[model samples]
Target: MKIRVLIADDEQTFRETFSRVLMEEGFEVTEACDGLQAIDAIRKDPYDVVILDIQMPGADGIKVLRETMSLRPDTRVIMVTAFGTVEMAVEAIKLGASEYVMKPIIFDDVILKIQQQWRYRQLQQENTELKTQLDGQFNIDSIIGEAQSMKHVFETIYKVSGTKSNVLVTGESGTGKEMVARAIHTTSPASSSRFIAINCGAIPEGLIESELFGHLKGSFTGAHVDKKGLFQAAENGTLFLDEIGHMPLSCQVKLLRAVEEREIWPVGSTQPIEINLRLIAATNKRLLEEIKEERFREDLYYRLNVVGIHLPPLRERREDIPKLIHFFMTKYNSEMGKECVHINEDAMQVLINYEWRGNIRELQNVIERAIIFAEGDTIKVSDIGIFNAAAIKNDNDEYDLHNAMRNYERQYIIHVLDKCDGNKSLAAKSLGVGLSSLYRKIDELEINGNRKVTNLA
Candidate 1:
């Protein structure tokens, strides 16, 4: 779109010449004979830049500028003034005019100022639109679960997202604590700014404090330049601290002060910088235990725990496993250009029954691995690969004898059926069982006939 320009001047010759010049320069120029017409034009249309002559017959430039600001503070206005009224023009600028142009106006300077203001307005609009799109994408439903526990988490996120309260998320590793933090930020009032994430455990102990509170140039060895910390970086947005329990006690004191005072004192700087950001912290380890062990500060724990959101481990929400599997299968199929569209009931059963020691992260990894190794359109028990030691070790005390035997029987039937090219009669013959018995077993195991089998011959 062409940049829109509005020229409001009492001098007919100057107004027409300016309009024609801007038009020749490819701007969409509109003219107003006086200040009243200028206000009317502003009320009726949106202009990227408005020019008003300070002295007019019907109404003056100062009156128009004030009214324009009251009506549309964002509309960039340039004041045109004579040498005698330069002070008045300066006052006009203080009242929100973009800049004052001395008469007789220099065309090139006016064009440059208009272009600058126009570009700024364009960038502001684009940024606002991008923020809206991002906020829409980071909704609670994006978490992808329907279990009661997840439903509760969604509800908590929804309620807490609209406020300025700090949030502390607790769950085992890979339980989507960071994801929950993003969801809260996306739905919050400050969604337009930024969402800065830092892992407390990932940063080295020597630099963690500086990383959170920023550092002045030459504050410490190898500090080649000044740096903005996560708090300042997340201005008007959210700062997500992952693995917060891993933060050292020394850093915790500074963090606690920052949280309490809503300001930060950078390293090697006496002046404190005030911060306006929402803090969301997450940790897999129990912070209460850390506090008791004297590894974490008790006051910081209470400060961060204003609104706690606990994400349940995947094993505890087994009911959502199938849904998650389907979600991932569809996702990977599109991403990898594979046609592995189905998961056999037995494979899904194993996924549900097995303990997910690493939680949802482990489950997603398993699915991606299975997709890589899957040979057919369907995912079979054999495609799931061998269970990891963590899973088997965790299942040792919880395994039921009957279910274990049934799982083994299902795997054996699947193996024979795949070997027989999905032919139940031939599979039965190879296994030394009657054809009717094989059919009955297939029905009992709930195995589908959609498996793409290899011909044994």
Candidate 2:
């Protein structure tokens, strides 16, 4: 990442000289003549380092430093003073000045100091990323969900991942079954290793065996070079076979043998190679019915289904619709560089009430497409086609039993909070909630980002 620095000094000579020296060190520098100017710069763009003069008009370096620290503590501030008073500089340091620089700063020394600060910032960022990943124990429990049917699905993944047994994740097409596999691998002891995924249904049957197992040189028509299969590549890791229901019966036997023996035989190779892998498979079809109809193997099905995790369709998780919409809006806003913030109440109601037959995946695609075409800062009713007035009213008027009436307004508020990425104050203001009550209500609603369901070592 580039080093972004802000230089705030009243001395034109000092600002020009310091700016040139820092730029020579390959930092992106923004210059400000006073504390007020510095604050304006900070407000406009995020900076990694701020070199502030101790004395300035409108706002002093101390106030700018304090405000900057509160807004973005990650930013480092280096105090610069022409007439260095040791006591004043010491107080500034205590107030959050990263370090103090005196007048007549050597150009060489200037580069060295900025480089050190930049390195320190990088190390801190890396530590934070690692810590977040480490402390996050992924599990279905962590997903922000509140539907009874979805709750049962999450519980199933939990029970299954705890055991070393095989898991068969059954769900309709577009349901997040692959995510379930990832949660399992991340929580398991094999987390540090690779999590290799393959779509058994998508791979051609002729190439399926070689793809799962290794292939020696000259083993087949295109076998000019030897290659390690996904199983070996994911040694001691996870191998998620998606659409296992579509796997050929012949291929199923080889997969079954590989799972049972914990080894594999390369194509046209006699020797079998041992593998340390965990198996998690997913399918959209009922294997038992397929087995009864002689389209699937009962023995294979039994082996794969030691523990079953059946993800209910999206329509079943109606409570999560508002959550998903806001999540997608945030995603689109960041990607499209749009300042788009909240979703309209009336428009959100359209999404909640719609029958999402295609499930979460479809909903995500719809939201992405809608946001890309959105015209305003806040997502308007007309931006997405879901809020068509006539169609929306018809659906509302036709439903005889409005008994399952949704808390549309409440849901919208919760969704906005999530969209702000869990920033309580920002979420509160966006949702029109008072700062003091926002957190209270978030806890009341139990609306925290759910940690992904994963296995623990």
Per-prediction tally of clashes: 0, 14
Sequence-dependent TM-score of model 1? 0.67
lDDT of 1 by residue, 354-453 (tens): 7887888888888898899888787766677744333232256447767666656776777677656578888899999999988888889776655543
Q: What lDDT does candidate 1 reach at residue 452?
A: 41
lDDT against the true structure, per candidate, is 0.85, 0.76
Prediction 2 global C-alpha lDDT? 0.76
RMSD of each: 7.0, 16.7
Query: Can you write out model 2's per-residue Cα lDDT over 1-457, one digit (the tens) per residue?
Result: 6789999988899789878877776889899998888898998888988888888988988899998988888888888766756577788889877898887777677677877887898899999898566436244433555688777766776666566678888888877787778788777777777778899889988999999997999999999999889999998778888888889988989988988888899988999999887889999998889998988888888888888888888767778888777777777778888856666554565677777767888888878877786665555445565533222323444563342223333345445644664467887787676987876665664544331211110
Kindly report the root-mean-square deviation of model 1 from the true structure over all alpha carbons: 7.0
Find the candidate with the highest lDDT and give its number: 1
Q: What does the lDDT read for residue 254 in candidate 1?
A: 92
Shift in Å, residue 147, candidate 1: 1.7
Candidate 1 regions exceeding 4 Å error are: 1-137, 386-403, 415-457
